[model samples]
Target: MSESKRMDPFTGEKVEVDGVYENEAGQEEELHRGDAFPADLILGNTEWKLTEMSFDNHHEGRTDERLVPKEKDIDKQGKIDSPRRQMDRGKK
Candidate 1:
């Protein structure tokens, strides 16, 4: 089977899932799949917030049973880290 992949938030590597990588500062960081995004991993230059999201639930009398909890943060439109901080995130 093809390996699943996700870009390392710190190094921008489209690495295979469950792999480990070194940062620009030579810090070893492990990668995983199926986990919530880490807000702290985002350097201090990005804007992120919880936007209301929902799913259609037709089985429970057409009522939405679960509003996604607020543990995850979605990036605000066009919000991104500055090049300087993006560089810092990869440093020791």
Candidate 2:
């Protein structure tokens, strides 16, 4: 087993890692996007190594703006946002 330190992007802390790790697993993934990706490896622990990537530009990540409610739509507690809550509020 090998030992290494990696910076945690979320917590901004030093993370200690043990075992054989792929330090440059997705090195090409940063340079590539969607279908234009260069070959990158998604290594697994003694199980697999994924060197091929297939991407579809037709189905990108997008959240419908209609699904997102405005800040005014949600009350202070954020629980009174839906139509059901509006009805409940009218009863009160």
Among all candidates shown, the one with the greatest lDDT: 1
Q: Estimate each model's TM-score.
A: 0.23, 0.19
Q: Candidate 2 on 1-92: residue-level lDDT in tens?
A: 33355331211222232112223343322222222222223442222122444444426556555555566764444444466655343544
Residue-level lDDT of model 1, residues 1-92, one tens digit each, is 34355333433323334444444344444545443333335352222222222233454545342432233546433333344533345548
The global C-alpha lDDT for each of the candidates, from Candidate 1 onward, is 0.38, 0.34
**Over 4 Å off in model 2, which ranges?**
1-26, 29-62, 74-92
What is the number of backbone collisions in each predicted candidate, taken in the order shown? 0, 0
Instruction: Give the C-alpha miss distance for residue 84 in model 1, angstroms.
Output: 53
Question: Each prediction's Cα RMSD?
Answer: 21.0, 13.8
- Kindly give the stretch of ten consecutive residues in candidate 1 with the minimal lDDT sum: 45-54
